[model samples]
Target chain A: MSEDHVPGFNTLSIHAGAQPDPTTGARATPIYQTTSFVFEDVDHAASLFGLQAFGNIYTRIGNPTCAVLEERVAALEGGTAALAVASGHAAQLIVMHTLLQPGDEFIAGTQLYGGSINQFNHAFKKFDWHVAWADSTDVSSFEKAVTPKTKAIFIESVANPGGVVVDIEGIAQVARRAGVPLIVDNTLASPYLCRPFEHGADIVVHSATKFLGGHGNSIGGVIVDGGTFNWMREGRYPTLSEPCESYQGMVLGETFGNFAFAIACRVLGLRDLGAALSPFNAFLLVTGIETLSLRMDRHCANAVAVAEFLSSHPKVAWVSYSGLPGDRYHALQQKYCPKGGGAVFTFGVKGGYDAGVKVVSNVQLFSHLANIGDTRSLIIHPASTTHRQLSDQQKTSAGAGPDVIRVSIGIEDKEDIIADLDQALASA
Target chain B: MNHDSYPDAYIREILDSCRVIAMVGASANTVRPSYFVLKYMLEKGYRVIPVNPGQAGKDILGQRVYASLSDIPEPIDMVDIFRASEAADGIVDEALALEPRPKVIWMQLSVRNDEAAAKAEAAGLKVVMNRCPKIEYGRLSGEIAWAGVNRRTVSSKRPVLSGGGFQRLGLGKGRTSN
Candidate 1:
């Protein structure tokens, strides 16, 4: 469809990246399960490999089915281009690989997903890439953390599990002053909740494994390049400004113009890292994305009711859902996620640790799982699970308390969700 | 003892035996309460499992990290929590689904959820609320040596009579002690 015919979110979700099969008239995106595609001729094959042309060469680098997903996600996120990857972690790795080299550094929020924290803290250390951790709640912290080596400032649009919302505009201003790009992980607050690009984020990433898949069936990730960051003006990014040795010394910035960084990620990063998304998973994710607006609406509405229910319950000691008026992040939520804060939130049981366990053990409707962003309700005790690797101090900083429980409200009937919670709390 | 009033003995035994907890939110930062409580639990020998999703698949307190209670893939007698009440429902739901449901569900100080508690109780799960497991364990295990003395000597001695009782005592006379 043309820009003038761009449809609404729901409509675009279902039809943006695909149409009926050109040959067989199949409605769904077909999984090009094969590993390689035949080229039109020797010149075409050479051009594909030389970046002179665009076509699928191998599944390891790209695939026709996955391409649809990338296009749709890029369109949905309002980005110039996107690259689908194996996982959210892989997406970060690929983005960093394309943006940073050994000895380069990046500034990131302290309140990021714990796995990302570990990746930046330990795994990235081997690559000699340093991360300056800053408090997402404080823009000044980010400013202080930025150094000459900083290539990007990263933060989650809404922090994971903790449900803390970052001020994208404020951070973007900081990044602009530092002459670096702002990379926002819009995983928790998917585009449906808040579009980070609209708020000045230069790049957006998602663990399409979560809400993007919605069904908990697929594991995938994507990076959406806003095409706003000027790589040529910045002498710092040699990867983009200089000629790439692997691509016959092609200057990505000069060749790709608006989409240099994204193209670099696809041709260089994914090629080396081998983190390309599978066509099958891409199809599943696209299916989930089709109902994105609808599911998010229900997820947010149910979460609001659940947050309110927990806030008022006698058995609830505290509630940290931004949807609640008294929550510290409520104002930010109103400013950012005006429709409602994303479904995930935390609360403490009145009777302490024992009660916390009891409540978790009693719920019948809610699934006790580690993953979030599912259509079904999911729960976990961070102190005993996802954050167990962190010390008490680290856990506290991450907002995972010993008596705290995390819930990802699903798109189920709000009354039923509340009822299960009611009974569980009573038993607790 | 009122059998209905006091927690079951088996539950008490289970609570007593557990040591060396991995509390996911065991905040090492002193400002966070979980820090002190985790330290206290560690001192008490209860292996506190620290399970923060953000920090998952790592090591805390020299113990390998697990992403969720189910992910532990080992015998965890109890799962202590310091999360919000809304989150309790899902945690409780997960706890019950365990192969051998946890012995106890302890909500930390200032945390509670009646429905979760009731559901756990119905599922034959022991539940405690508005109380930290570390504090309770210390108190019940005699680790808080002065707790009894403080309760008896300090609290019991302070007799603030209710309005109805004060009237019955006829305090208006300002009677001297004979």
Candidate 2:
């Protein structure tokens, strides 16, 4: 309880948003399995509904269990507040729903998870939200994409599968000039590796289904409000700046101030979207986060070793892990995620498409799957699986060329992981 | 001192030392943030006198309302400016003219005036801007953790709550020895 004592990352990971249960004094955060909370009386009910008080009413709006998860992620990201939802996709949906109006636009890095690319390109169009693609490796691409209609700029802290560390500060400047918020997807590099807020990002989004829920057991996503962006500056974002008819002319940006974006996401988007995370999944994710530092350390170590092995292998054409000193993004990795490159990266098999598929199918220890950031190593031949629908030109542009292979290195002993990949490569 | 950041000791000291607060622009509307902030301060055993020209002489959370700082008869320990940044200058000027002048001038969240802050600081009054004392109190006392927000500080010490109506924690325990 020293006056200036700030919690270490490991401490905040475990205890930031948690205390013992008040009613039962439960040491572990018990799952509040019920859907709704009972009000003490009519006055209390009125207060809760009117946003006059802070308490739980319905699980769809806010659950006690999910609130803990949201708080912990927000704390880790150095954000003022956070909101948790059913999946990473749901997290993205709620975020866009809050920021964008009909026919508005957001700029996203071209190198992204295929799922997000799809979400922005196809699903978001239904809401009349357009996605303008930019090259994260080149910050000027983001600058060129800026227009009056651009509501926000989005980038991945570390691009998925491509394994490039983005220059968050450079793009943040573009966002600043454009009068928009820079949203960084820190799913690849958890808070242990990189905190987006510290690098001028106005908001940080995470697909907690991956690294944040390290075991790959639960599906969840979180949005962390950096509390940096002034949502009222231009009145571009009416959801925050304007008065809400639903809540008696209360202006969220004026009332909530720094944490208004998070409040709006919860009270408006999630309330209507009905994407509430199950309490059990939140509990599991919470437990997963407690060991984040430990798991991430091993994840980074195993990934670097595996990348080194692949780079030297006879059948490997190239390895794209920034942890490698000679890799293109090595310097950027050091600048942003000095700890390590992270668990996910990509490489090229010498024999092209057939070899890539063979390597994935031949692995014993590595699970051939679409997911990453699991305790178990996962391998995917994207050209054959996820990118099959796209043309070869599209696949290459998306960083899923014919010879490309993606792997999410697990926290298992490095030698064991290398040994598994070695045999798999030999068979291929 | 940097207006963007404050040391924990600075914020903790201000919240702990100040007992009576005069909240300018406090509203009786339940949904407004100022209303809840006033309620929370009262619940935590801090006496908050509401100040609003419109709501003057009315009872807000059972505390007497005053039209202005000069009108209040009691010695104010702190003036919590819940008004906008443009209005902070006049509020600080009024606070500076008080007899046995308040020790602190605290601006609420997103309300900051550098000129007004400099004036207060020059007069030997501590100033904190763009921060909510309720959030700080909850953070320092580990009460924010109950709602799953990061208190930012780590502590193993259990909070000692006074025997009272609501179990609100205060930063007064360890500071008393100081």
Candidate 3:
């Protein structure tokens, strides 16, 4: 099928990168649950290995089912191409590895997920990739943070747990001025809430383990290339701009045109890093994506209701959901995620730590799991868990406080959620 | 019920004595209560550990910001939490798994988990719920200068109209009470 004939979100999610099985006419995408594909002859095998032609070389690099996921996600995100990986962390690593070398730096929002903060602060430092933290609310801070060594500017469209929305276009303008690409983690917002590409992001990434998968069953990640960044124009990104011995000296930008960075990510990053998503997980994620629009609509509506409930609750000290009019990021959310503010938010309980704990204990519906973006409502206390690794000062900076509780609102009935929360707050 | 059925007294003691805690959620941004309370705690000298993942390994209030409680490498008497409730279990588990478990698992004002609290209590730990140690400490230790019942005189002086009232303060008048 051609791009023009491709259908809506629900249709494309199921059939975007797949067709009926050529041999058996199977309606569903089959999990190519094999390590390697066999070649017909020696030359054909050599061509596959040499990247002279496209064929599955190893599951570590790519798989047929995972390819369908990548394609479907790319289409959903309005990107030229995408790569599915083992986890959201791996997706980030792949993008960074392809974009940065030792001594290269990236500017990132301070309001990112706590794990991402740790990755950028400590893990990425191991690779000598420095990250300058920028206040997502302040675009000028991003501009000031950029230097000659800066390769990318990264932000989360709707920051995890924090629920702060980034000004993608404003920051993208900064990246463009600095001759670098802007990468937005669209995990919390998802393509359903906001397509980062539409607002000027050069690339979008997701921890498909969350909303994209809908259920809390699988862990996966995806990187979508918006094909907006001009790698060759300024020669800032040599990995894509220059020729490579990795693929027989093929200059990615010259060969792949707009999708050069994404091709580089697959051929170089995923190939070397070996963080390929499993075919089974890919299939699950695809099924989840098929209901993305529906789930997101409900998620947003439920989240707004929950946020309002929390904000009004006497026990809630503060609520930080972009859907709320008083939220600091509400304006940015309106500009970026006009569809809806997303399904995650943070609120402080009135009694501080004890009240926070009491509410968690009293809640019957919300799952007390370590993961988010589940179809079922999820909640966590960051100061005690996810952000526990950080010191008191660090926790405050990350917006995880002793009194704060984070919620990843699900697509359940809003009334049920509010009722549960009301009882929990009353009990607390 | 047996005497053991009662919660541990050590937990109560830790919760009572630990004032001026450096809650990692202690914000430097004044608008953020974390900042005010952290400053309040610091002024009170109970020792605050600001645990922000973003600022981990950085300095907050002249204190080194460690990532996790275990990473603190020092004797932290209490683990006052500000994370989500789902995250509490893992943190409690981690705290229990520590070489020396924290004296109290103080779930922030609105945070709570009975299973986690029970787990900690089962492991000879103290659990406090629906309370801010800072406020309690202030109220109990005479740190709060105001004279009032339940500290409402000082704390409630700022008339935050409930959700049901007419829009005098931008908040509803009396529909909801906190």
Residue-level lDDT tens digits of model 3 in B1-178: 1212223233335644554343545444432435444544554446788877777888765777777766776666677777677788888887887776677777765577778899888998777764555455443332221111111111112222212321111111221211
TM-score, per-candidate, Cα-based: 0.69, 0.91, 0.69
C-alpha DockQ for predicted model 3: 0.01
For model 3, residues A23-127, the per-residue Cα lDDT tens digits are 355667777798976664675466446543344567887776787778778878888778889999999999999999899999998887999999999999999
Computed on alpha carbons, the lDDT of every model, listed in order, comes to 0.75, 0.86, 0.74
Residue-wise lDDT of candidate 1 within B53-89, one digit each (tens)? 7667766545566677877767777778768878888
Task: Single out the weakest 10-residue window by summed lDDT for candidate 1 chain B.
Answer: B147-156
* Pairwise DockQ winner, candidates 2 and 3: 2
What DockQ results do all the predictions give, each relative to the true complex?
0.00, 0.32, 0.01
Highest DockQ scorer: 2
Candidate 1 residue runs with Cα over 4 Å from true position: A1-3, B1-178
Q: Write down the worst ten-residue block by lDDT for model 1 chain A.
A: A1-10
Please give, as one word, the docking class of candidate 1.
incorrect
Which candidate's TM-score is highest? Answer: 2
In model 2, how large is the Cα lDDT of residue A205? 89
Minimal lDDT window, size 10, model 3 chain A: A1-10
Lowest lDDT 10-residue stretch of candidate 3 chain B: B147-156
